[model samples]
Target chain A: MSDSLNFSYTVDGENFASAGQASVQVKKELRQLGIAPETIRRVSIAMYEGEINMVIHAGGGVAQVNVDDSGIEIVLKDEGPGIANIEQAMQEGFSTAPDNVRSLGFGAGMGLPNMKRYTDEMHIDSTVGVGTTITMKVNY
Target chain B: MTINDIKNYLDAEVLCGEEFLEKEVFSACGSDMMSDVLAYVKDQAVLLTGLMNTQVIRTAEMMDMICVVFIRNKKPNEEIIELARESGIAVLTSSKRMYEACGILYSSGLCGKAE
Candidate 1:
C-alpha cells in the first residue's frame, strides 16, 4: 500500500437513498489496501455519519478521504444552514431533523457525536446560513 | 447462532445472501436509529431493525454485521436489497414485531456485544 491515497466524492442531497455511497467506497478501498478491520470500521462509521448528515442537513456536500501510512482523514464540507449551537448539537438525543428523517431511521442526534467518538481527532467549522465543514481522522 | 437458524427461528424470508446462511453470528442489536447502532460496537453480529432504507444497510456495513433482519413484516425495496447484496450482508424479513423479534433472538442466546 502507498503511504498516502486521496479519494474525493460528490454527495447528492436530492436522493436520500443514495447517501453513504462515499463511505461504502472508502470501506472497499481500505479493504483492498489491507487496512486493519477495526481501523476501517472506525473510519467508515465516522464517514458514513458525516455523509448522512450532509444529506439530511446540508442538502448535499463534498467528501474527501485521505489514506496514509499513519492514519485516515475524512473531510466533509457543505453549503447549507450551519449549525446554530455546536455544543447543543454535540449532545446526545438532541436533533433538528424533521420527523420524516427520523421515520427513515436517522436523525437521532448521534451523527456528530458518533463521528467524534469513532475518530481519534475531529474538527467542525460552520457559519450561520453559510456552510459547515467537518474534519475527522482515525489513526491506523 | 447461524444466520440459517435465525431465518428458521423467525420464519423469516431470506431476501439476499443465501450463501451466507451458515455464517456464525455472536451478537445482535435491534434499533431503528442508526446513531444508536453507531454508538455501540459489535463483532460479527446481526442487526434487527424496522428501518427499511439504504442507511440501515450502510450502518450494518460499518459495524461489520453479517445479517440484517427487518421486523414487522416490512420488506426492503430493490435498492436496499441491492445495497445489502453488494455488501455481502444477508437480509431477512419477519412478520414478528420488534419486541417479539428481539425477545425470540435473546432467548435463543443471541446477545449484544460487550462494551
Candidate 2:
C-alpha cells in the first residue's frame, strides 16, 4: 500500500437512477482496501449525498476520491446553478428542489447537512448561476 | 435479531439476500424519506420503509444497513431487488402497515436507537 490512492468519476446528469453509482464504487474500493466499516460508512454517505446533490441541483459533476493511511477525501464539482445562500442551504429543511424531485425520495434539504454530519471536515465553493464544488473528508 | 427472525416475526417474504438470513441487526428505522434515513440512521440497522424504490436500497447501502423491510405488502421491482441483492441487504415484504410493523419489532426487542 501506498500512502494515498486516487479515484475519479464523471457523474451523469441525464439519469437520476444512476446518481449513486460512483459512491457505490468508491465504497467497494474502500472496503477492498480494508478501511474500517465506520469510516467507509461515513465516506460513502457523504459521497452519496454529494452525488445526489450534483444530479438534482448541479445538473452533473465530477467526483474525485483520494484514499490514504490517514483518511479519505472526496471532491465533487459541478457546473450548474450555484447555491445562493450557503447558510440557508445548510439548514436541515430548507430546500429548493422541485416537487418532482421530492417524489423520488430526495430533495428534503438534508443533503448538505448529512454530508457535514458524516464527514470530519467539509468546504463548499459556489458561484450563483455558475457552479458549486464541495470537498469533504472522513478520517480513518 | 437475525434477519430470519425478523422475517418470521413479521411474516415477511424475503425478496432477496436469502443467504444473509443469519445476519444480525441491532436497530431499525422506518421512514419514507430517504434523506431522513441517511441523516439519522446508525450502523448495521434495519430500514423498514413503505417507500418502494431503488433509492431505498441505495440509502440502506450508504448507511451500511443490513436489511430493508417494506411494509404494506409493498413489493420492490426487479431492479430494486437486484440492487439490494448486490449490496447484500436482505429485502423483505410484509403485509403489516408501517406503524404496526415498527411497533411489532420494537416490542419484540429491536430497539430503534443505535448503540
Candidate 3:
C-alpha cells in the first residue's frame, strides 16, 4: 500500500464526448507501469464502463484508481439519483438511460454487466434517492 | 489478414493511421451498440460499425482493437479520426453496409474468434 500508485479524476457528466477520458488516462498509466496487457485491459474496460454510467445515469462522478502489488482497485463515487434496484440494473439489457444516450451508441443496458464481467471483483453500494459507489478490482 | 486486406475487401478509404495498414488482425466483429461490443468481444482485432461518435473510437481503444471500419461510408469527424490516430488504430470508411461488409470479410476467412 505504501508503494502503490494513486490516480484520481473528476468525471464530467455534462460532456458525454469526454466521458472516457479517465479510463484512457488510466490505461496509458497502466501501460507505462508495465502491467500485463490483459490486466490493463480488464481494468480499463471496467473503469470506462463505470465512467460512462456516471455520466449517463449519475450526472457525473469521481474516479479513483490505486495500483499495488496485489492488484488494481478502482472506485467510482457519485452523488446523483441512486440506483433503485441494483439486481435489475445488472441485467444485460436493463437500462434507464435516455433515448438520446442510446443514439450515442450506448444504453443497451450492458454497462454494469460489462463491468462485472471484466473485473475480478466488483461491488456496488447505493441507496435510493442518495447516491452510488462502485468498487472494482483486477488482480495483477 | 492485415488492415490493408480489410481496406481492399471492403473498398474502404483509409482515414488515418496509414502507417498501420500493414498491421495484422485475426478477428472482426460488426455492431453499432458499443456495450454489446464491450461485453461479447474477446480479442477481436477489427471493429465494423455504422455508429459515428468518439465513443466508438473509445470503445475500440478500450478493447485494444487494431482497426475500425465505418460501414455505410459514415465519415467520422476530425476529432474521432484524431482519437483513433492517437491510439495507433487504423480508421477506414466504406460505402458498403454493415451486413455486406461483414459478410465479405467473413468469407475472406475472418472469424469472430481471435486467432
Candidate 4:
C-alpha cells in the first residue's frame, strides 16, 4: 500500500474491563494488511499499554494509529490528571495508581516503560491537572 | 510444548478452546501482574497466573500468547472465558500452585526466553 492508513477510537475511561478493545481491533487490522507479525505485536503492546493508561489514569482518551510504508505511529491523548513527574513515572517501579488498581493486576508502573520498550520512538507531553498526550512509533 | 502437554503437566482441565490443544508454545511466563506479563516478550508462550479477570485474557491477546493456565485452582468467570474463546486462546485451570506449576513446565523444557 502506497498511501497511509489511519484508524482512531475513543477509549472509554470507565469500566477497566472494556479497555484494550481498540488495540485488539488494530491488531486484527494490521494482520489483514499483512504487516509483519513482530511489527504488529510491537504495535499492539505499545498501544495496549497506552490504552490501559488512559483508562486507569486519565479516565479515558483518544487513540489514533497511522500505518504507512515506513512505520506505524500511535497517538494517545487523555484529559486525566497529568503526571507530576514524567521522569519518576518513567521509572520501572514508581506508580501513583491507587491500591484498587494494583488489585486488578495493573499499576505496577510499567505502562510507560513498556510502551517505550516495544516502540521505536516515544514522546510524552503533559501538564498537571491538564492532560497527557503520548506519541509512539514502530518502524516496519 | 503443545497446549495439551501443558495440560497434562499441570494436571489441568481445559476450560475452553479444546480444539487448540495441539498448538505449540515455545516459552512460558508465570505472573499475577498483567503489566509484568506485558513487559516481557515471548513467542508462542503460555501464561500461568492466578489472576482471574478479563484483563488476563486481554494481556494474553496483546502478547499473542497461545494459552493461559490459571494456577491455584483459580477458575475464571464466564465473561473472561468467553473473551479467551473469542480470541482463540486456550484456557486451563490447575490445582497446582503458581510455583509448582511453573516448575513443572520449566523442568519439562518450556523456558521463559523468547525463541
Give each prediction's root-mean-square deviation over alpha carbons: 1.4, 1.2, 1.0, 0.8
**Candidate 4, TM-score of its B chain:** 0.98
Candidates 2 and 4 compared: the better one by DockQ is 4
Provide the DockQ value for model 4: 0.88
Work out the TM-score per prediction: 0.96, 0.96, 0.98, 0.98
Flag regions of model 1 displaced more than 4 Å.
A1-3
Every model: iRMSD: 0.8, 0.8, 0.5, 0.6
TM-score of chain A of each: 0.97, 0.97, 0.97, 0.98
> Which residue runs of candidate 3 sit more than 4 Å off their true CA positions?
none
Count of steric clashes across candidates, in order: 0, 0, 0, 1
Q: At residue A11, what lDDT does model 2 achieve?
A: 97
Best by lDDT: 4
In candidate 4, what are the lDDT values of residues B1-115, reduced to their tens digit? 8999999999999999999999999999899899999998889999999888899999999999989999989899999999999999999999999999999999999888877
Query: Mind giving the per-residue lDDT tens digits that candidate 1 earns over A60-139?
Result: 99999998878999999999899999999999889999999999888888999999999999999999899999999999
lDDT of 2 by residue, B1-115 (tens): 8999999999999989899999988899999889999988576799999887788989999998999999999988999999998988999999999989999999999988777
Q: Global lDDT for candidate 2?
A: 0.92
**Candidate 3 residue-wise lDDT, A29-129, digit = tens:** 99999999999999999999999999998899999999999999999999989999999999989999999999889999999999999988999999988
Better of 1 and 3 by DockQ: 3
lDDT score, residue A50, model 4? 92
- Candidate 4 structure quality by residue, lDDT tens digits, A1-23: 79999999999999899999999
lDDT per model, in order?
Answer: 0.92, 0.92, 0.93, 0.94
